[model samples]
Target: MDRTSVVEVGGIAQFIREIGPDEGASPPLVVIHGGPDWDHTYLLPGLMPVSLHRHVILFDMRGCGRSTRGLGPDGYQPEFVVEDLSQLIQALGHHTVDLLGFSTGGQVAQLFVESHRRLVRRLILASTTAYAGGDHYLVGWQEYERRLQIRAPRPAWAECRHGEGDRGVRGTVQWALDAAPIAIWDLDRLDEYLALLEGVTFSGEWLGPFREGRLHAWRPTNPEQALRDFVGPILILHGAQDMGFPVQVAQRLHAAVPATSLRVLDQAGHMAHFDQPQAWSSAVLDFLGG
Candidate 1:
């Protein structure tokens, strides 16, 4: 799994990874990760388990993680991100694929399917939003501090002490770890969960735009208007208590898309797959296989 290849689109290089069996699988699952700034590393274990059932392709959005970085706001446009994935699929020799877009990645997936409807087979929208009417769900420090009350016990905090190293990567990691009680409902593997997130790599460039108010002001021209033409199965997998996007956002998305299966997993938050790995993976497999 160490070997990776870059798929270039519009001269911007995007990183791509593949795992699990390619044969005897439904359409290959292509995953677009979260964080306009986050890389694909934090989605592991939850996603890695799905590989046992089928081939999974995970890619870091341009300017995030191991891909090309330091691209300013203009370069991180939504269309550009969609183009990168478009060419990435072509580069992988896949005509169509089952897609999973988590968090911000889910927004990218929705837009991509709208523009390239025929290239998608099954759609899984996990912990994401439609961002309609130009809504960029940004959380404030006060609210962040409020969210911290849900953080795991002090022992769990010690597991991710590495998060306090530096302002860029470390701070971002600490913030995420601080939101643990919201992330991991089943505190059984708290140490393993923190370690996995701490190990996930990140890029400073993606954060610069967010803090500068550049990325937040941007929105898709037509998130659902374009989707009116796409007549395919969409699985809306969201956390029952997702404070980040709220379950209502997922409800709206499912309502707008005529053909959608909504699965609200109990005891899960914004990161449903992380909170309920077994249930989440099984739900994904059942939907994709159906």
Candidate 2:
């Protein structure tokens, strides 16, 4: 049977939801979520299909979801996150496990794998990028803005320190709502995804810094270059129509990392799991074959 509870790890209470058998499985799959302001809820439904047979472990990072925050932006550093993951795995009595990271979560997984190379068995990077983008960093967003022709100014996270009036979870949700159109590639699925997101509970602790676009979380100095020695299975999944990171970014990442495979799902966007559930899960399941 699946398990659900909160475990205090690395000086914080982390909320965990497990699906499928915990033992006699190949290896538990740990899913790291994205968003400085979001949680793991959006991923649970899409990944449930795979969890039916394999142990699926999902948790809210400190300062997100129901997890208790440590302090503020300083507490949300990448080092602390790596420690949290390491301690959580040990607490669960797992010496090794497969990891699936989506978006910012992928950044976390990559950082963890880079540091604790021996602990992770496989790595799945879905709809994520390595660094914050290089010379072409703002190209995609610029194109999107041009197409949108929005008269209203985009919310600047760095400037909105006040958290858009409500200096709490609601403000973070506001950021989500504002970034939705830029995040989702498939315009038709925007409303449905937004509806699902409405029920998601976000953390207000880090909302201010996150809204300001101040991310001190892990980012690769050179993503592919950093993983030169990594020997584990690496799967790079991207949406063919992704506007945020774009498919080209995925291609470069795939090319840089050795022993990595890339699969681009058509008609998908930044949130491929929501935009193309069947295809997204199928690729993940196939890569994590039992």
**C-alpha TM-scores of all predictions:** 0.83, 0.87
Q: Give the per-residue lDDT of model 2 (tens digit) for 1-290.
A: 67789999967998998987766658899999988567888886568777776889999888888888647666767667778989999999999999999888888888888888799988998888886654364465675766354322333432444455546766766667667776666666666766677567676776666557765756656667656667898999998867667788888887777579999999887888888887888888899985
lDDT of 1 by residue, 212-261 (tens): 77663223466666555667788889988676777778888778876789
Q: Which sections of candidate 2 miss by over 4 Å?
A: 134-143, 146-166, 210-217
lDDT of each: 0.74, 0.77
